[model samples]
Target: MSRRVKNPTGMRVLITGASGTIGLALGRRLVEQGAHVVGLDVAPRGDEGFEVIACDLTDDDSVTTGVPRALDLLGGLDGLVNNAGIGGPAPAEAAPGAEVRRQLEINLLGTWRVSAACVDALVASRGRVVMVSSRMAVMQLPLAAAYGASKRAMVAYADALRLELGTHVGVTCVYPSATRSPIHDSTAAAGLSLEGMSTYEPLEGVVDAVERSLLSVRARRDVPTTRKGAVEFFVARHLPRVTDRIVLRTLADRARSGAFDGAALAEGVVARHAEEVSR
Candidate 1:
């Protein structure tokens, strides 16, 4: 069985990607609830009403040193939120490139590194771990294969972690639908924006889900940030063929709409989608 911290007051928590949209909001909210929150980010800022640690999740030495420092600051940890991640556009048909490797490095391995570092401390406190995954982890979209694959792999890591730590530490994965954030700036710059394809949900919904997962009496194994996301996740997980067909249809629509017109990375998908639509 997983454990919960009934009271938020004085609960020690560590959050990664604390400088980003979701991480900043989550850290601030936890601090407002009287939790001792420490944030880890590549570029740490001190004005967020919580202590921020400078830790580059992509660097092993940074995480190795920074996580321990966070544990020390809190004296012990009651919760760890793997909220740090990155996104970029990479088509499935092309050979994986730098963007693909980067997405996997920071989104998947970075989470894994931080989670591994906190294992002993989390186990000691009988605490919980919350993975801030993406809706793409379940329902993949076209032209952003790297982001989907990375998040899906992160979900797998969460599942394995849950099984390994179920007796001593609770693990939960929270999937949030697209929200307005700089994380999408790169993809948008590549002219592969998800604007029409993905509906943006309130960031608060994701924050709430993460908080609930950490403090609930029983940790939820998989939590979608919204009702729509729950339905999407269900369809993708249980009716994969249905999900694939839906995605293909959407891709065809987007292709016909010229959504991928100028994106070099999306050329293949656009061509294939056009051919499929004609037939």
Candidate 2:
């Protein structure tokens, strides 16, 4: 059996992008466990439980300022969950140069700023870092060029940070398959939709992964830890031509299905997927 660290009740945790799906879920889970949680976001979270602050992650000053504000509110942080992200479709036939750059600013650069600001605190507390990444990092997915590339780079970044932070700072990178999150907005913004897109993992998969990381003694965990290799194997086995055809067909269907509202779809799909996976 894997070692489960004794629960650190009343310990503090700092969660970035707390307004998001997995972020909110993580925050609530921690709160219920008796941990003090501080949330940083660019927008308001409908979840009222966590201590929320409006901090801009893309700006260095904002992150620098956020550290103290978070530490002050929570008294100190025992963990940090970097979960802020955005997604979009890569226009078929068009290179996703700018969008990729933009995504890096938030996913990569933003993470850099936040982590740099929190390293000392994390070290002092012997805490861990959980980075929210995506399955696109492995390639072979359609319309996910920008999100994929940024996530790909983040994997390397997290690995290096983990090695450097060593023995003290635990770093875990989480990769989720097409999850039903605010990413639906991103897909639509990119002129794509999830029509005919039948596959997705529940947000709870990531929530449970990061939750385990917080209680972990070592500094790393692959979110949905046991499932990564199997999922990647399926993708690797499929040729690019086959994947591309699926993307084209899916996108065509999305275009025909009219606009999609993310919430309703996520609720119904997530329930079904969770039941299927549980079995």
Candidate 3:
């Protein structure tokens, strides 16, 4: 059943990946809705409406210290937005094992760290936790193996956490289609590309959805669909093996032509990766 989330006013939300496109927009929206927001990012702060801090999620100290500092600065946290993640868009050879490990560390482990640290506070406040996953978690994307894995891991984590926290703290995992943020470029820069990736929706829409998700009690949300994403969803579940074959064929064709744009895709993947790394 879908749960309705009320307006977030006079509430406190700690947002990680606050420097990235969606993260920044969501923070802005939270503030506009009269909620106190504390932004955590990997990059150095350059001023966003709410307080900004540098913390590395992959590191132990960052989670322990950063989470508390965020709560302290905001006085208390009523909710947490686990929006940080990384994706590598490179051919298997070019995308190193170490790099994929790092992606998992940031996307999965880091998400777990940050959310766990705030669970007690959320349980106390009856606040929600928003896990910003990707549509890739639902549909397989060619040439974005690491990205899909990380997002899938997050989906599993959110589901587990929801069952654990059932009927007390709300947990929402959002699966959004392609969004034009530095995140898209980050994927390309990281040497990874999302096959059939489409340019859809403004950054504002993602943030607005996050803001609305703040009040949501549902366990999952699949945001507005993109043409490709819609088709993938419409077809994939009923034809998993067939869809997999189609994705592989498309990738093989691109590889044969030597026309795939890994760099372009990596740019956003890296952006998504880099944002998640921020403390």
Off by over 4 Å in 1: 1-5, 276-279
- Candidate 2 colliding pairs: 170-219, 171-219
lDDT of 3 by residue, 19-99 (tens): 888888888877888989998888845767888789899999978988888888887777888998766554443445776
Which model, 2 or 3, shows the larger TM-score? 3
Task: Go through the candidates in order and give the C-alpha RMSD of each one to the true structure.
Answer: 2.0, 8.4, 7.8
Better of 1 and 2 by lDDT: 1
- CA deviation > 4 Å runs, candidate 2: 1-3, 92-98, 194-198, 225-229, 233-279
lDDT, candidate 2, 1-279, per-residue tens: 147664858878898888888888888888899889998898866565978888888888888887789988887678988888877665334555766667878988888888888888888988888888866665445545667777878888888988998778888887676667776776665445554553577777768777877777665545543465345635544665665576556544453344333433233333444465568
Sort every candidate by lDDT, greatest first.
Answer: 1, 3, 2
Q: lDDT of each structure? A: 0.91, 0.72, 0.73
Candidate 3 stretches greater than 4 Å from native: 1-4, 90-96, 189-192, 217-231, 261-279
Report lDDT (Cα) of residue 218, candidate 3.
54
After superposing all C-alphas onto the true structure, candidate 1 shows an RMSD in angstroms of 2.0
Worst 10 residues of 3 by lDDT: 265-274
Residue-level lDDT tens digits of model 1 in 222-243:
9998999999999989999999
